[model samples]
Target chain A: MVANHELQRAEEWSGLRGFTNLLYKENRAWWGTRRWWINALLWTGMLGGLAAMVVFMLPTIAQATDDPAVAKAGGPIPFGLEMGRTVFFELGAMALAIGVIILCQDLIVDEKQTGLTEWLLAKPVTRRAYVLAKLVASALAVMILLVALPSLACYLLLSARVGSFFPFLPFLGGVGIMIVHTLFYLTLTLMLGTLFNSRPPILGIALGVLLGGNLLAGFLKPLLSVTPLLLGKVASLTAGSQPLPPELLLYPVIASVLWSVIFIVVAVVRFEKTEF
Target chain B: MNQTHDHVIRTDGLSKSFGDVQVLKSVNLAVPAHSIFGFLGPNGAGKTTLMKILLGLVRPTGGSGTIFGRDVVRESVAIRERIGYLPQQPRFVEYMTARENLTFAANFFFSGPQPKIRERCEEMLELVGLRDKADRPIKNFSGGEKQRLGIALAQVNYPDLLILDEPASALDPLGRQEVLEVMERLRKHTTVFYSTHILDDVQRVSDRVAILNRGRLLTSGPIEQILNGRDGVVYTLIVKEAPQGFSERLAGLSWVTHVSAPETAGASVWQIGVSDEAAAETALLRFVLEDQNVTVTEFSRKKYELEEIFMELVKGESDGRQS
Candidate 1:
């Protein structure tokens, strides 16, 4: 027998029995290894690098060429901080959503395909704990690396030129909306992981939701309020402090949060019914 | 449903199917605690499927199973808390070291001082002789090495019931010997439920045995009882000089059911089947000595080999199905 004092008896039988340990393992896969730094470089380079190029390169090119059109192309808003907000919120929203889908696409499907899920479920772990751990860990990684870090670096870069800090509350609101929008795809991809055995369906359906929703939203205006399609518009409007009606913003925010919770609930329920 | 306190695992009418194809028929098994129960079967006999059901990796379609009297489906986490399973093809995170894999599995049941967990991991590493390679990544380990690590990981929790699916299938003879030795040491502490095709190992380590064929259990009992000759009592005798009428006389006896004498190297090897073992024991040797020309060299009850019995059982089941 194993020594009594060396290991606890594990008396807890809740659905979240092994949640903390599994979450620690998933977090270690991100934070304990070089995966965190690698992701840091990738997202920061993609989002922050794009912001840097736009902030410094556009005005320098405009000045060197003496082209009034190039200067005007920076948009009607005062150039530095406003342009940064527009780029970070508008393009960053779409890029980070795709990035989250690609990064977390394999989280469930790969473990299932490789028999790791079978191995884990044989332990004291419940199916809910397994899916929930993947969701929490991946969501935190996406939020930190994909949304918050890049936004912070972009804030500093855009603020360096303006000689005044951007409004903290609006920037925070934009970041919060970006997190919810990306998490919609994160939970959707994870839910797909429990529903399907392969990675393609998970990737295709999740990316299709982001890309397909954006494309078809023009034809179906209702998708804007029901899905995450109009999230970027709301985020950009919030970050730029442009005034808009509450209904235009409130619907998508509530819908995204509701959709994320629904996806998580479906993932846990479906995974419980799944056989090894 | 038997709910016996002595049995570590019990299944009644456990069945499973994949789509329209049935993989496991109704299997009722009782594995007594602290006994090495060898689950034997031909390929596709549903041994692994049954193990999976007990482990809660696969849900049963037809029946109910319990470990420590908890329902397998409803109380799987509770069942898993006291059991350690090594799957047929043991898999781990490829990037983690052997020690890390062990530590990770250990944490599933254990939460305490970090040093104690590390110490337990080290003990398992040494138990499987993987101490030298503890720090190497799993991807770099060979097949046999990985199997050894798999054993260590399975035992790190010191589970009350250790379920192994072909635990020694990937090992060399020497490694197989070491694994058997470890199982022997653990037999007094835990009930070992393992499945394998190697009948020699089963005969060596297992006290109880069950054989399955084509999704149905053919037979199960103690190893000695299963090897005690399922047919009837038979005794073998080597006669160096036996006249032609000598064999006829023994065959004509009332207690002797049948007799066969085959010539080999100028000697007659006789297999005498008897209905009354006491009658044969008291009279047969005296009767053989009555023939002055017959010199009896060897006389002993025939001991059946496990392979022979397994083949006879499986072949009989197959033939019964075909017929």
Candidate 2:
């Protein structure tokens, strides 16, 4: 019985050994990687801003709710503050977009310029693992900062403004939307990096896409007057004044999927054919 | 056979053309299980192209290759799962310490299991002789240390096959020794396919070598057999007193093609191309004692260095085949 057990243990040890070996073989190598501290420092900054914003706003939100006046209030501004609602969506959205691009830039373009791709290709790591780890890490960082931090900010700010309030459902919904949008954008950024394989070109491509997409939507708005295919149907959602038509509301989702799919295909294809 | 290593990579008639120039011309080579095979070549010899093809990084213009017997062009995942590669120039995230850099790398491979990784990371750091420098940032590391870390990372999981292209080219002598020593140690468990113009390195470590020149393999075999040929005769004869007519007598002798003067005064050395080296050895011994030398001290066979033979054969073959 002891002999059998020893044999089993030895077998299991070999199996573990094999797994660790595979982890090295199939895993993305860190050789030729861009500065890890840069990514770490960048992540800390984004999350730090969110933490500070939440900490600063939470007490004020609690005090406002205790007064009962703001809690029971209803007005065009949501409270009596001037030019306040713009601060919520406008600043938040812009911050989210900027943060997402910054994080993705390091993950994709910076790594390429540092010659990590050649090193990575020499290893046994699959293209899927390499790109996905990058996308996931950066996207997760974007989500934590863009979605989670902002969610906390909104909750504290909203609770303080309205008093005696929990905005859990709305916060979750916003975060969910932000995550989906970020993934879509992340996918686009990855494709651009793979296509260009250089810094200035990758940055130019990513910047062109984000800014160009919005500009394209604006340009397509006039065309929408003549045709249903135009951005007229989707661009109108930017107002946030009226409830969305189900199809029109799905526009971002659809566009996100479309772009993501295109990027996924391009990355997979480019990955297979490239020589180290 | 173990699944990960079974048929990991394969290729056939693999060729590549960078526009009008043909870089890899129908090149063929194979890596067996657990052997240090040196990809010997000069610059622009397409060894790099062959390696890239194995890695599935570049699309070949023609032909194919295999890593672990699997189709290199099609089943790269198979090849990838059992291999670790260190390119000629290895770059790391400069700002992060070796530890942090390794941790971030571990995440992509491990995905979870934090405790195990910490232990393994320490162990790997030790293996590459960088345990004490774990906390030191990679940017501050000298070229040797960074390269040591590079080798550590390459072997972290103890891959079955480690593909290192010119692993010691950028290193100083000490740095080169460190890398080569680590590779030597790793050879016990892993198969290393190292490419380099450094023939001494290949001579010191490689069991076998494949010489590539002008995008084609000039010759490939065990270093010993290939270097001196199977039966090529080499001799080192030391005499107590030298003869004035030693060169004249040795020169026109049958089966003796080349001769060189000795660094020592009373030493006579000659390399003869004889069909049977044993027969030539007997004949040379008789000729030396009977002909001229007053007394012989060290009369031993010459051991050819791989570097000299390699340069001669490959360069000669390429030059011979060029026009």
For each candidate, the DockQ is 0.61, 0.23
For each candidate, what is the lDDT?
0.85, 0.63
For A1-276, candidate 2 gives per-residue lDDT tens digits of 011112111111311222332233222332225434444445445544444454345445644565455454443224332113234343445455555665565565566667776776555456655665565555555566455654565456555555656445544554455555566667767777667666666667766765665667586764223222322223223322335675555655566667677887787677545555
Model 2, residue B35: distance off in Å is 4.2
Listed for each candidate, the true contacts retained, as a fraction, are 0.64, 0.38
Q: Which ten residues in a row have the lowest lDDT in candidate 2 chain A?
A: A1-10
Task: Give stretches of model 1 more than 4 Å off.
Answer: A11-13, A59-80, B1-3, B240-269, B272-294
Q: Please, what are the lDDT tens digits per residue for candidate 1 over residues B186-281?
A: 788789999999999999999999999988988888998798667677889998968878878998999998888888997889989888989998
Clashing pairs in 1: none
lDDT of 1 by residue, A1-276 (tens): 248465665554586989888888899889988999998998888889888877766665555675555456563225545566678788999998888888988998898989888888889898888988888898888789888889988878777766688777887888888888998989998899889999888889988888888789889888888888888878978877778798788899999999999999999999988887
Docking class of 1: medium
RMSD of candidate 2 to true structure, Å? 7.7
Cα TM-score of candidate 2: 0.73
**How far is A107's C-alpha from truth in model 2 (Å)?**
1.6
lDDT at position B155, candidate 2: 71
Q: How well is each residue in B124-196 modelled by candidate 2, as lDDT tens digits?
A: 7887888888997677788888888888777765667888888899889999999889988888888888899
